[model samples]
Target: MKRRDILKLAALAGASAVVPGVLSEVRAGPIGHTGPYWITIQAGWGWDPTLFCDPKGAPVNATYDKAQIAKAGNIPYAPSNENDAFFGKYASRLCVVNGIELSTHQIEAAFRQMWTGALEPGYPSLAALLAAGLGGGAPMPLISAGGFEETAGLVPRTRLVGAQPLDWASLTAPSADMASLFSPMTETRIAQYRRERLKAKLATSLPPGIKSVIEAAEAAELSRPKLEQWKAHWPSPLSDDPSRALIQLTLAAFKAKLSVSANLWWMLDPAVTDAAQVENFNDWTARFDVLMDEIEAFGLDNSVILVASSGGGRTPMYLDEQMKGHWSVGSMLLLGPGIPGNRIIGGTDENLRGLPLDPSTLEPNPTGVRLRPAHIHRALRRLAGIEASAEAKAFPLDAEDLPLFS
Candidate 1:
């Protein structure tokens, strides 16, 4: 098989293994992830950095003056009074990466590029890479509450959100009503017989394509038991807010050892055009703080790497519509155990254009490279210790490795 075909088959097998109805007699307990947990929060509809982290004055951002920029440690944030609480509380743990240059300003392409590190379609998302590599035997692996769900068929994406309760029993059960179905022991025996027949059938010579499908079926049978363990960790009453619901689900999964990475979406009010827009962003950050608080409460703070990135950025200069247009430059915030805190890496000029940086020192250099999503993904793979994994290799982000998390 060609390399791409092999990858596709492997991805297909992985995707198949997560299906809810795989039948097996073995009762394997839930597998937990003891390593670093990754959580990526993507801010939808383009976010304006000048309204939050990267501050400007007068013509750039008419709302805030350059002199009004607030300092929290080494990082300087927007002048919005509400931002003080967020920056002040988490600045010590936050590694702000500014001036990320996106190749395209189109929303769909920007979202794909920002999270997957590939401008073209078909690459697995960063969350997928983390799950495929570091997730180990996590049943759900990567729980994508919202935003990019592209997995390149590498792994299955599960959406466990909101106050709704999951019907775990129904997923694996033989029938809707137990009274009308075969007994549990009898059903288990029937499943075991079916698996044995499939195994015997696979023992005979077969075409590569058919053989791969059978192998995937066998893998799914082996993985069926893990799904039963999720019920113990499901939250009692989930939050109504989509973002908060994602956080709660991810944390519970982390605690249950059911997941490794999660992708979350930040849906800000796109209608707000004035100063309240800044507050809207500020309020979201405050909610982000609550995520950290709960992580700490669960004693998983040290093991979690938190990321909040924008799909794209709004222009520094206002357009004729009295609102900022899409800009090529973007920003990201990383926090957790290994990342250097209270530091700002990369930057932009007054016009919100990305600056070239010396990859080695991460300092501005006239003859250096501008930061891009690929560079960030490369660093992230290193952080997750998955740079050399087959999944990462399948979807390479050919960029110089900077010490982003060190």
Candidate 2:
């Protein structure tokens, strides 16, 4: 294809999903990874548990009565949105964990705690850790559209939101008419000279920091071609919807073996407002349903482990009679072939405090510990079979190991 045509296609479809640093140059055929892909979709801004997977009654939420709560198999969900349809379709595949107690209800702290199992900044997100821990040969390893961009420098962090048109003219050749400015023989000499200079510099003593940078540059050069090869798998006629576009690009990377885990974000429509909270949440669920369909269509339903959650939970009561404030207790939904679904672990009291669950039974145990993101992360590391990996050990989550997936 003409380089211009490729740039035009990327611009029109927002191909911001491309890998960076080492993801430039010539194109080749796809490279595929076969099993156990990881995806985490987090709802930006706090979401209301009373209106989502964890339904509460009366003074908690005057919007819906407790009597209106509905059940899908063993799960009880708020009657808002297309809950009946959504839950009916995936309840058997879902492991809903309510009452996630956070150390703080503030947005930033909550986000850090929610995904990294750390209350402090600087920890890599679960997505990053998983990609670094379990990643085997994927070029990008971890990609994020939005939500917890930190990778703790453990893996290459690729973002699928700001891909710009490359200077293909300069990249491929000096001009459109010519493939190269020099003959193949001259090109070979030039390459040898460049390598000799790089090797000579490396052989000399240098500052530790500069030496590391030079070594990293060499690694980047080596990985560039693999990233280029992944271009053959980019979806044609990309979807216009942002959410769908993100999913499409992510799946393409997954199928091409360029990435192992991705973090995507969605938010309640700001225009929907509190008066239409139901509509906002409905929109969220509909997108999730579409995600489910997209995965299944790619024949990845069985291989993808999905986690859907919010940065934090909104309080049941409205603040300033306009909107809900952050609540310390939140919830998360896990689904995949690996987890036994149709299970509800943990709970919240009427006042919206997290109730503890017995570590052994995963049942409500007032005397037991409240479920936290650390616990979930610990369980997730085990579930992905990477708890013992050096990557996991380097950035540890000092959390109690719980049998969350059983």
lDDT of 1 by residue, 264-347 (tens): 776546733646567568767777877887787668878999888877788766667676667778899999978899999989
Alpha-carbon RMSD to native, per candidate: 7.9, 3.7
Tell me model 1's lDDT, rounded to 2 decimals: 0.73
Q: TM per model?
A: 0.83, 0.87
Which pairs of residues collide in candidate 2? none
Q: Report the C-alpha displacement of residue 226, candidate 1, in angstroms.
A: 2.1
Pairs in steric clash, model 1: 32-257
Q: Which stretches of candidate 1 lie above 4 Å from their native place?
A: 1-32, 161-166, 171-176, 179-184, 190-224, 237-243
